[model samples]
Target: MVSPLTVVKSEGPKLVPFFKATCVYFVLWLPSSNPTWFSALIKCLPIFCLCLFLLAHGLGFLQTHPSATRIFVGLIFSAVGDAFLIWQDQGYFVHGLLMFAVTHMFYASAFGMKPLDLRKGLVIAVLSGSSYALLYPCLSGAFTYLVGVYVAIISFMGWRALAGLQLIGAAWRWTKLAAGSGALLFILSDMTIALNKFCFPVPHSRAIIMSTYYAAQMLITLSAVESREPVEAYGLSKTN
Candidate 1:
């Protein structure tokens, strides 16, 4: 029988080319401010691959925890959001936002199953509230209300992720941290999107926003895998 360790070692090298291809496609897609169908398809390939990667890892972790399935579902929603947003000119912005809102819900549900620190959750809530206060003046009408709702949900997701950082297992520590950081970055990326779309035009905002968004998704996916590792191997217990 093939050892899990050996399988991991063998599979590790395959990711290098996948990552390289994603980078190449992203770079090519970046030059066209408004890309043609072919260019848009190329741009979407990286996100599609990233979603596949997340799904694969999430499925692999399913034996360890049912929460892993939530991660997979979240990634699927994220991929749909990516597809919608890629064609923003076709009136898909609202659709993309709704998809992502659902994505955050799944992610939040997954993280919420873990132990949380109430104090940290409170701190994150305050921060998110402050951010919304700053952005509210720039928005108006129905868009304002929609954005506000999105902010609230995504903020709650981030808070749950941050609270997970205090979880007491060593094997889960890095995973929790990565997931928390990813949640924060996801908020940052969405905030940037709101600012660029409603408040002001940020220079090179597409590159900045997509880079953070991709990194956030990747990190969250990695955390799902990391979260499945055995705590005993790291000489730690689940209790604080």
Candidate 2:
């Protein structure tokens, strides 16, 4: 895909709300042991803001770049996942995992599987497969297949992102970098979660997970805005 360098940056003001919501979660919610049920709203605020940001950026992309639209929908699913996760100790882990699995499917669909380089896909698959193996002993019988399936989907998502990152002409473009980095960071975030819950406790796991997760989402959101168009491109009319 082309870089579409003309619209490389998203509107900075639109990100303020997302950052503010993240700060509130990290500062007030993450540290609180007695967080109220209503705090689930705070947990989802950043994702909600991101969905609004994508909509506010514009909808014209849906005509030519359905990928951006898919990511927007993915973010909405992520928000639901976040809500379910807050109650994980109450048996919502599986529900939350299901939502996030759907989120990865949307992201993988948005990333596309074109230029399917076996080398790249294989590398990602090996990494994800090894990770699942590492966690195999800790996984409960009920969730063994579920977690395995989730890992496979996310690994495929990363493979698709990696393939796009090496677009013949736009190898070094910000769109590629953003999407690729976002996918990697997303993998790291989920891996951290698995280690914390299934394998062993990670130091400050919640903070690390949230920080990387939000940053990954932010980068992915920016990529959608950059890859899609604005009102026009040079002398070429997008409406054409």
Candidate 3:
């Protein structure tokens, strides 16, 4: 025997737009009611909304498809981490990093690094590595290993993406640039969060960093979706 609630759950995929709108509204309304409690919920809601949004887009419900499964996975893990951090759950932090690492690897694969020139890859690597080195000292002892793995994976991904942009040229330059910038910010935000959690405590830095990080991700993905070239332009011979 199933209740109406179960039925609604079963039908959720069909009503994605409505669900997204409601989630957006609810999160927006949270700040006034109970700031602390709702803020936590708002942190978690983005993950839920992102997952649903990606699923809906993949299923052809959305107007454009960015094929950003990798990036979305990063967001999902980040949101989960944010939820855990908000509640001060250290156990889930490792899980979040593991998920984020996988996301970075996927993004690296999407960048398709094989064709990139060595000079460009070297330049990108140097830039990313320098940035990571600057922040490495600030991470918590417990999170250091996980952060190391994350830094390696995401840095490589960023390098590959940058190389891809350079090699591929302006065909989709803005889109890739947006994604690269988003990835960089995402890394910074996570490092700041770890610092706050286990090393130095800061006030409200978590929220501010995360807000910017999440916004960067959304913009990157939107740019990617808008930058896709038409398949027909490949100019294959028209066979009867």
lDDT of each: 0.73, 0.81, 0.57
Q: Residues 135-195, candidate 1, lDDT per residue (tens digit)? A: 8989888777898899889988898777767445444466677788899889989989988
Better of 1 and 3 by TM-score: 1
- How far residue 164's Cα lies from its native spot in candidate 2, in Å, is 1.5
- TM-score, each model? 0.80, 0.87, 0.62
> Which 10-residue span in candidate 2 carries the lowest summed lDDT?
227-236
How many collisions per candidate? 0, 0, 0
Structure candidate 3, residue pairs in collision: none
Better of 1 and 2 by lDDT: 2
lDDT of 2 at 141: 85
Taking the tens digit of each residue's C-alpha lDDT, what string does model 2 give over 1-240?
Answer: 443544434367788899999998878755335545678888888999988888786676554567788898899899889888888887888898999889889988877777678899889988998999998999988889999999998898888877867535535666667788999999999999999999899998988898899999988887776553333432445452
lDDT for model 3, on a 0 to 1 scale? 0.57
Using TM-score, give the best candidate's number.
2
- Candidates arranged by lDDT, highest first: 2, 1, 3
lDDT against true structure, model 1? 0.73
lDDT of 2 at 63: 45
Candidate whose lDDT is highest: 2
